[model samples]
Target chain A: MSAVRERNSSAWLLPPRPGVDHGLRKDMRRFEDQDEVDIAIVGCGAGGSTMLQRLARAGWTAVGFDAGPFWDPERDWVSDEAGSHHLYWTEPRVIDGTDPVPLGSNNSGRGVGGSMVHFAGYTPRFHPSDFHTFTADGVGADWPIGYSDLRSFYEDIEEELPVAGEAWPWGDPHKYTYRPHPVSGNGEIFLRGAFASGITAKVGPVAIANGRFGNRPHCIYRGFCLQGCKVNAKASPLITHIPDALAHGAEVRADSMVTRIGFDERTGKATGVHYVRAGVERFQRARIVAVAGYSIETPRLLLNSANARFPEGMCNDFDQVGRYLMVQGAPQTAGRFAAEVRMYKAPPPEVSTEQFYETDPSKPYKRGFSIQTVSPLPITWAEHVMAQGHWGAELRRYMSDYPHWACLGALCEFLPLAENRVSLSEEKDRHGLPVAKFSYSQCENDQQLLKAAQSVMERILTAAGAEETMTVKRYAHLVGGARMAADEHHGVVDSSCRSFAIPNLYITDGSVLPTQGSANPALTIMALAARTAAILVKGD
Target chain B: MSLPLSPRDGGERYPGFSSVDESDHWDRATQGAVLVRLGLPPDIRFFTAREEAVARALFDQLLDQHSDPRVPVVNMVDSRLAEAETDGWRYADLPEDGQAWRETLAALDQDATERHGQGFPEVTLDQQASLLRAVQDLGYAKWHGMTAARVWSLWTRYACTAFYSHPWAWDEIGFPGPAYPRGYKNLGLDRLEPFEVRDARPAQDPAANAGGDG
Candidate 1:
């Protein structure tokens, strides 16, 4: 963290005390010592932290654990390309196959805030039709629960978090109370292109607060969203739900990496989580257990928790724990502008067009993508632009038009292919845990989606008066490992995101997304977490 | 906290994990590790002296930088090779990066010897560029025994990471570099902070500052 400037004559010099047991040590001597709680959430990321808030508000004792330490943003946050690498999940997992997935720290995260610390806060809700993709498009599995099932849950989360944006009338289930953030320069150019290209565009209902909301400051637009948000403004769970849960007597054990879900072998019910902290194995007893380790680690944990009763890994009766992984495309197309768009001047883009989200038979793709205006910072520019060069002048030529470069990319929808998945590899990680081996391949449906996005983007950028369109990259968002389904045998988790085989186990993260709509999955993950919490409150 | 295994000679099969015992110091800062040129260790860990010399020569031509005030691109490559930190996977036909670098350098030297009657490092910059283009253009030479395009990308990725991660390169591009406690307030479109510099080139022309016939 850098020197702080004052706002309202008093700036937050440091974050509030996280919890009473924020950094409690695990006493290995007391091997049988089990701190019993109402709920035990493995991973204090977006979903777990959101669930923690609800559980605490309902007056339930909850404890959360994270593999990484609690980042003291004031002191620990770094703002460079090298420094940003620390914000993402650092465990070794092989992402291979046809498309060499950049499935490392960039897509996942650890620590208290989890990946949301590095997420762009582009939290768009999935459309109502997104829940029934199988029925509408005859492709992809349908979500067991519909938009109406999680409508109020979405509202509950939106009200608590400082989310901004107007609700889309097309398929948005709930009314977003707060308005969207001001349009960025990138958004203005994108809007011009969208309007010209005969498509729809609107400001987001993103998790970023419009301005100063409560104690959190407004967006200064430092463009470090991919890195850790040092200002505590970017609505990461580190600043939002984690703090609230801690205040409500929820205990958080940072540096506690859960290795297995402890179970009663006889009844096959989850006892709690078995985690290693400070080189000691400890087990906490809980009435309920949830693994919210995003997409990768969630399934990895399930596969690792194999035992006698459920020898094929706990709750993995169908061996569907790590199958059917979906890496949705967040592709970018670079374009040169006449003047200065200053696309990188602000925070993440406020406006995004979703007119192409539905299943349009006229289009080449089964589903579509949402394209928004954006610009790359210098580091990304160096990799994607300057990297392909003849010599110094080639790199320099790309750098010379820094002020005049603009881009619009898509969070394209991806359907589950049985072959594109994650499984335990022969190699082991630093912890001696079996490393996740990926078999990902971008299918023809993805190419069709990209072609649609490319045509729309070209028209939009051409409309926005772009001088040239450069390279295109398909950045993937990890989704669909422990997918939720109405039919028990068809998917990993049931409608409530609870394991159909194991009663006490729940998988509530992006892993539960049966279908990844053309929207950033953070908002949906949080809403589902809230919905799961609401269901648990009903004693289901 | 204790990471379970003590990696020897920078063998991370997967790079960038600290003692995984705890997570504060998770990354070993492998990419931009402390830039030290003090004692020089007297020798290289991964690249052979011949490989290093030729790779450095090729990069100098590729980056159009044959001078000081340049970021240590060859050192960075050596560091990555030593750590076994790769781009994870590459083209199936091409060997791993460590082997690829060695093979490519050997080809460039051999090609230079055949044409200019000199080693790759001893050739003129023009001759060096042509030899490099043989691998890139997939010309009359098999070059690296791999596709010319793959060889080009291997060198390009290493050179780009080393060049752009430095403060010198950040200054050249007018990038404000690193956002932290001192975040931007003048954040509107076309707005610049007092510290930020405007580009001194034709803004619209994508190829404005090629400094060549390009």
Candidate 2:
């Protein structure tokens, strides 16, 4: 038989009901019948899945709904050519642009696993100053909860995700002891060069490679992670928290899109969420509704759920639900070395540097940025470097020889400005829902940070004996649109991720981040979700 | 009787010819042989009118070069030729339905497949079917298909290389090279220059295209 035929035949090796639980079926039926749960989670991505697991473990029943499909690593992993399918979040062109560029990272996974399926799994805690940007830097608002309050939650999230790295040695409260997997050749080179330059660098924790801690297998370092992993290595919500939630009778409904948040006007609280299921609009009522539909869709849902009591939109009484938008603009610099560094085939770069995490008032910017080394495949690297347009012979030659190229990038923090907002576009989808239009820009401080980060990256590359180096100036990682704070007047959600205007509605996604942090936001988002779950379960 | 020129005599007659240059001759000879084996006319003009029109059609058809090789140049040849022909002429000389054109394409496809083990049109069609299957099975078609047309329009306008290399063209028409963008610096069209339309043809030798040193 041909290879294709043999693979097709072997696809049925597993039972039809694989990864399904009897308790989950029962809970799903309960949700279908409109049974009330403690919370109705609107999304099942990274944040929603973590929240469900925490809430369920704390003895609260929850039902999670996601329009995206689940990911099965074994079934999903194919050849490199077919790996692009792993990046599918929503239906292609669902969020239409003239260029058809995907709205976000093929970062979003729809199905059971959500986007955790394709996540790079770098987990870094936000700096202490990140929680109090308004007070410290005189920009953005302060989080109701400080780094001290979230420290324990961050530790819990890291444990749940089972990261491998030594704790921060600088005596920061958020630091914890971790044994990260050994660094690769490129990672080691980056570490040596960064440290030689007096930069604080270490093998930061990644949410992969635990030896069966949470019923998930250890990472096999396949390096095909951006596609789904067949070995259950990556700590995605699908394999980690979602399964735990299901074991505790929590349910998840895939392909179910929540259209609007149902509200009881008299009490000024959300009653339930009305969603579309298989072309039918059905109402699923609950005492509490937690919108974890990510930063963009979370605000879009609030804007779409407008009622007479809150004319602007649900929870938009202050017109601040989608304001204060920020994306972590990661301008990177890459250098080619004369070594046979197979960076692409290895697990993601497990180490990073935080020498620039603090604010540098002497420079043009008040807030600073963090630098990290990452491993990328030839295709991904080519996409980044060639974005400057060095093609044909020069492109082919560069790609063929630069397999050992090392990259140093900065996760620069963007100030949460009120002008950066998400609004409904006049254009509507097939379902007649208004498309989301995002208007965002970087401040002068952000540009300065980028420039300084570039200088730092160039210096490090030069120290590392790099033959050639290039820098990317413009890039973004969407975050901080619906920030969390102490007062409802300044922010949308309160300290515990509860919307002050709507008591029963909680948002635990990137939207609740008070300010953009100079680190990967996934770990922080997971930590916040865990924190919120603890509060809601304790009835605080 | 024309006397056969010795290798030394040939080198003396054509200074560019030498024993060391056999590889270049071999490359040109191989290309000529392949065209002949496929029963295509030596001149690219035999396939279409106007060099630009031929280049565009070749660009569209080249997409299927890797997948199916049974598609005939005749399929893309006539439409381009007809457009060029109409642009150059005021009155209609032949029927626009292009019955002769269709026949020419059918004959070319059949002849090429029989002679050279593959033809452009058949291979192009088969490759397209395969791509559609891949895209549909991966759910890309369902997600991106509705908007792919619009995306293609924008991609063509902004990134012409992307349009030229788009994989979908292999099935729909036989286009090639929609590989991921690499080594492409944004020049912003400021380097536009005029080129003389020369009667000289491009060198068929593979070495001439190698290294791009030429």
lDDT per residue (tens digit) for residues A1-540 in model 2: 233222111112222332333444455434553777778998887789888878876767788898865554434443132224434543311232211213434334556656666777777788778878778878767888888887887776666666767667532734444467666656766776786777768876677754544334555543556655555556667766776676666778777888999998898888888988889988887888999887678888899889898888888878888888677767778775655344443466467777787787777677778777666544455455444433323333343343346777788887888877777766565467875666666778877888888988888877776766777554545566677877878888888888988889999888888787787778788888888888887773
Writing each residue's lDDT as its tens digit, candidate 2 over B1-214 gives 1112222211112222221222232223223322232344224443334333323332343222322333333333433345332111110112222332333234434444554466534354444333323322342232222322222222121222222112221112111111111111211111111110111111211112223310
Per-prediction TM-score, chain B alone: 0.74, 0.21
Candidate 1 Cα errors over 4 Å, as ranges: A1-33, A173-175, A386-391, B1-51, B76-155, B187-189, B207-214
Candidates 1 onward: DockQ, in order: 0.21, 0.03
lDDT of 1 by residue, A1-540 (tens): 011111111112223321112232222012133667888999988899888867876778888889998877655665555545566665656656777566544477889888888877777778888888888888887877888898776666665565777677556744565677666567777877778878778877677766665556777676767777666667777766765565556777889889988888788789999889998988889989989998888888988888888787767787777778888777687677766666666666567788888888876669888876556676566666743443545555566456677778787887888777778876676678887777778888998887778777888888878778765565757888888987667788888888898888898788888888888888789889988888998984
How much is B179 displaced in model 1, in angstroms?
A: 4.0
TM-score of 1: 0.84
